[model samples]
Target: MRLIRGMAGAVLLAGTGLAVHPAHAQQPGFHRHDVLQHDLSVPGREVVQVRVDFDPGAVSVKHSHPGEEIAYVLEGTLEYEIEGKPPVTLQAGQGLFIPAGANHVARNVGKGKASELATYVVRKGRPIFVVAD
Candidate 1:
């Protein structure tokens, strides 16, 4: 019931001239809700925003984007591990920056549900996300 409601806003880009089907592990406990997106002034660049919710113990597996991402914690604790960097656990109102092409993952380390607002400034015509090995 919650998963269905949470998934109602999961919008994926289609007309960006790229067919991006991220082969990410589909976890039922995790959901993504796209909030907004726009073409940046920079040619070939665009910005997108999404709200991600994580059930207790839910995990967003390793993945990478074409550009950069800013993540703000909105609810519970989330641990982010960006490649080549130490793992950081963020609480409500905290934030983290992820460099372009850096592989990363997020885990809900809190007892309750966790949510984060992620904004990405990424290259247009490229996959917003790619599953990482």
Candidate 2:
């Protein structure tokens, strides 16, 4: 179907570089799905939503968002760490917000795959995510 093909292309593009870092290759079973993107009613703003899946023991490198980010766990458990705060474990039905420009990392700490829905309110034409040293 057309929709399936489009989704597959989006996923491939997102994984190629739009949302993933080269270092991500070291993390097995990590996948990012570009769910939707739309220009916000507010000028110069856009809302992008993605579904991120992390297999057991997978971890992401530190990164920052170009704008505010909100994430909700859909399944399993995620260990999230943001600069200046202690890491927190979020289970299904829980969510967290990350202020713009804050460095953060996420890891799958559960026995199964962890999935989360992430929404970002970002500046138009800017990369939604940036790798942080």
* Residue runs of model 2 more than 4 Å from their true location after superposition: 1-13, 16-27
Compose the digit string of candidate 2's lDDT tens values, residues 19-132.
333323323467877688888999999888888888899877677788999999999999999999999999999999999999988989999999999998988877665656
Give candidate 1 misplaced runs (Cα > 4 Å). Answer: 1-26
Clashing pairs in 1: none
For candidate 2, list the clashing residue pairs, or say none. none
TM accuracy, model 2? 0.81
TM-score, each model? 0.81, 0.81
- lDDT tens digits by residue: candidate 1, 1-133: 5444223212222222223443333446777675877889999999888788889998765777899999999999999999988999999999999999999889999999999998999998776866565
Q: What C-alpha lDDT does candidate 1 achieve relative to the native structure?
A: 0.77
